[model samples]
Target chain A: MSSATLEIVEPGLLTTVQDAGRYGYQRFGVPVSGAIDVFALKAANILAGNAQDAAGLEMTVVGPRVRFLADTWIALTGADLGPLLDDRPIPMWESVAVPAGAILSFDGARDGVFGYLAVTGGIDVPVVMGSRSTYVKGAIGGHLGRALMASDSLPTMERDGHPDPTNNRLPDHLGAPRYGNTHEIRVVLGPQDAAFTAEAVQTLLGSEYSVSIQSDRMGYRLEGPVIQHRSGPDLISDGTPLGAVQVPGDGQPIILLSDRGTTGGYAKIATVISSDIGTLGQAMPVDTIRFATVSVEEAHAILREREQVLRDIEKAVRGAAAEAVSIRIDGDAFEAVDDSGRLVSAPAVEGRVESEATRHARVTVDGRTFEFDVEVQRAD
Target chain B: MREDLRFLPAGDQAVVVELGDTIDPQTNRRVHGLMDAIEREEVPGVFDLVPTYRSILVYYDPMLTSLPELQARVSELYRDLEDHAVATPRTVEIPTLYGGEYGPDLEFVAEHAGLTPQEVIDIHSGTDYLVYMMGFSPGFPYLGGLSERLATPRLDTPRLEIPAGSVGIAESQTGVYPVASPGGWRLVGRSPVRMFDAEAEPPSRLAAGDYVRFVPIASETEYLKLQESAVKGIHAGDAAQ
Candidate 1:
């Protein structure tokens, strides 16, 4: 007698519910907890026809095993973790329908670290200080503010229309980067860039740092050539916002992230641009990161470009065919039609779903195309 | 903050405006002045205004206003701010129980400060501290003006867990821990006051630029009683004798 949507069977490494972020409360020493790969989360939410900031599950290097309690459409993005629905492999970065009783599980991450999964309606969690993101340190927000464990049930957000949010597509160009071993994260020098010598600043940009094993949602600990500081790495303590590249006494540059302290004492050499934070977030442990400094004007320009690209994706979603279609992977293989109507290959699919009838259905099997009897369903 | 009134970009979403280089109370006042001025005017697109020790970080939506436009507005306010709108900080006197289990690192701080345990408590509660900023943990005030006699460095290796309400001293600063966390600060006492409560209005009990003092309680039972009162929505300021 409850509205539980998904029940966790195998709560893998670290899976937590997240949204855009918790804003405004950072001054109260609250971290803005959210998905590391925010762009990927946004893209996945978009593909599921949900609002860009809708709450979703963020899987870490590994993913959890969940069983659907209700029929829903879902989208997965960022890492190519071996996602399987019911037992068969499923697709990533596209909307897929899952009937009630389907069990979803992931084998392991083939690439990337964090993976985002968005349902048709967002994850229905009580927002703490205006965010669904989990700040586990505070034990607040997002499924009790910790990594989801076995037997945990997730609630689905209430929605009016568009029950089946499958078949929506995002252009590959605007999508967040998939599994990659390295990232060229852009930075805008200063806030504390003067704390370091000019040679050290050059060393920061010139040298490539590897994402250390100690990295987490709080900050990305880096291992690379130490960037020497003219003075000590301590400041009189100040507000350290997102993407602050704090050099500590150890000389390693730790790029603070979503769950970092509201303020810190370490001198920051530079800050990663808001646009490139998503890229930085997606870089897995042991991945190489090369820094490039740009002017603040250029940083703003880059962020504007990202915003424009998001607008383009939204426009494209609105411009699609009137009757939404379902791209299901039956038996084996994959195939789909691009927005331009060209035949394209697809990904794996869900375990099992027994849907009796549909308005219009198409099935592709072994290079042969099968179309179900056409039954028109119009919104107007 | 070497540059007076420097506007630094905090990524693309926020701007860090530095008031002064030093950690002087005047710099904090200026930071709070700008904060009050901005809060009163209520500029469009400015989402969150965070005031720190010597600077203010303004988080805004670039879609509504550009970096330069926000900078111009801030500059105008800085130029025109004749009256210090910064209010005299409210004084919060936290009732604390010192030494024993409540404060595990009491002896450490006592020896480090070259004072008897009783002298440590006396010196600690004697001075008034200004809430310089809040950081490290929720509602954890970064206080200024610990008595120089009680100044001590933090532990070389921090304890794995310090309970919430533990008043700690680290390198010339003293503040209560608002939440349970691993910290390097030497423990001196325990405060019954809830520094942060999500359900409470304003969330944080102590605001930046607020004045604070500690009231000494003799017994752990008194501390427990006050803790119960805090959970029931009553705070130390009201219960302080």
Candidate 2:
């Protein structure tokens, strides 16, 4: 089958193409600029069997109406959008086989603030600076480095095969990613914690604040008690990291997000844990926010557990698919070629009949070429 | 006093050291030396090395290394770094057109310095400034070592956007805004020279370890001609100067 196309009917409140993030250029003062709810974006892609970092539509508050130009497999996740297929209700958190020229319209979101749409084989957008994420401030990546507009056409790559309509289901609780709007976002006390008054620290965690209307991908300008810095001068600019809660002289806490400037002068009082950053990003304006403190060890344990869960899910998926075949290369060394034209030498594998499921193979030095049916196991 | 520097965990694997309240030249030099040492040792887990006026933030990976291990390595290098000599620095020359439309706020800065516009330019261009760091925007340098007489406060309110290549002074510090950004610094002059080029390998003409000296030119006609040739990618005339 040929590639599919999706013609946007009504562009939502805020819809943009997003990928993983921009990296490795922080030293030059460039922001990462990527998807706000990274966890949700990743899960949506994996559920659709797309690349982990594939570009997808990030719809916030309101989602767009799209009409498919060809048959494709797609999944809608993150927020609970009251979606209607030809005026008929369609459930969230499940794969849906879109027929040729079918209209997919999602109205106002009821649960979370952001929703994601992931198509199998992913959205095809030109990558800039190694990412397809839109950096609105710099106008760098994504689809022409801007938001999708009405009547814009997006092309989809070939799918693994349309997901069976019967298999279109997701966990009930996971239908819409839950948001405890008042949950204390766990954070590690910052290097500049001592620079603020003890009362300031107490006020930060104990009190509740509202996400201001000024919030965007750059940072969230929180409205609450003024966080005062006791004895720091106009600091010579320094590098700012993701989730850094910086308090400028004005006293309001601005939580820096994915597209925050690489360096800043304001004193950062706290840094939100990586696990909770996604929660903060999904919070809507006027949503109440509290703070909690977690030790470095606890954060690591949480991360490890999350990774394990992902690995388990992948394993389950792999078991349901075809089994891997093993092959061994003889005396000659095999050469591994990457997109960058650089080559690394590996042990040669013996030629063997490729399994029907094997699209690629890992050749071992002891004369064996392991069929590509196996999932990649990373050291981490 | 020989108290051990307290190393605090930032997040997953990053460590941040807060070297409390001192902007003395000696402290700044120590910060630079420590960064050089950490780079030389090549600690495996550490991915990014960021040094500021007082603190040094090191970002690392928890999977490959632990926080305590990275802290121990930093402590070891800190002790070893005390004996190293100052590394040779590169000097960057910025060609600027002082006063007139190119530097509309030049008169204001001159008045703040208690001198005529010509005398203010003389004192400002006389001293060499070090590039402390690159931040705010790409290739924008935060330079230190300004003459006390040339100190000027920023505008009462910031401008919505300032043009790129505009050089300004705020209090005792001076900097060049490499890209057009919202700023409040008291502008003194604008440079026809391009401080940043996205096409260039290094992208920035100046980096954290370099030094800078401003050279003032006369007349807008000369400035425009120089700018046109520079945009066409010329570098010959200034090198001869």
Give the number of the best model, judged by TM-score: 1
lDDT (tens digit, per residue) of candidate 2 on B1-241:
3235568666664677644456554555666777777777777567676666666777775644677778888887766655347576677888788877777889998887789999989988887898776666666777888999988888999989888788889999888877788989888888887776644445567767667899887778888887887784323343554
TM-score per candidate, chains pooled: 0.85, 0.80
User: RMSD in Å for candidate 1, one decimal?
Assistant: 11.8
Worst 10 residues of 1 chain A by lDDT: A363-372
Q: State residue A354's C-alpha deviation in candidate 1, in Å.
A: 60
TM for candidate 1 is: 0.85
Q: What share of the true interface contacts does candidate 2 keep?
A: 0.38
Deviation in Å, model 1, residue A43 alpha carbon: 1.5
Could you give candidate 2's per-residue lDDT for residues A1-380 as a string of tens digits? 34448888898887888876876555556567888877777666756666557788888888889888877767777776677776677766666777887888876777767788887678887766667788776666776667888988888666545233334444333334577566568888885687799999999988899999999888988999988788862465666777888998888899988888877887788888777888898788898999988887787777666654443433333343313323233323334432333332354332233332333444331111123443223223
Look at candidate 2 and tell me the lDDT of residue B162.
82
Candidate 2 CAPRI level? acceptable
Quality of candidate 2 docking, DockQ: 0.38
How well does candidate 2 match the true structure in TM-score terms?
0.80
Total residue pair clashes for candidate 1: 2
Residue pairs that clash (backbone atoms under 3 angstroms), model 1? A85-A351, A86-A351
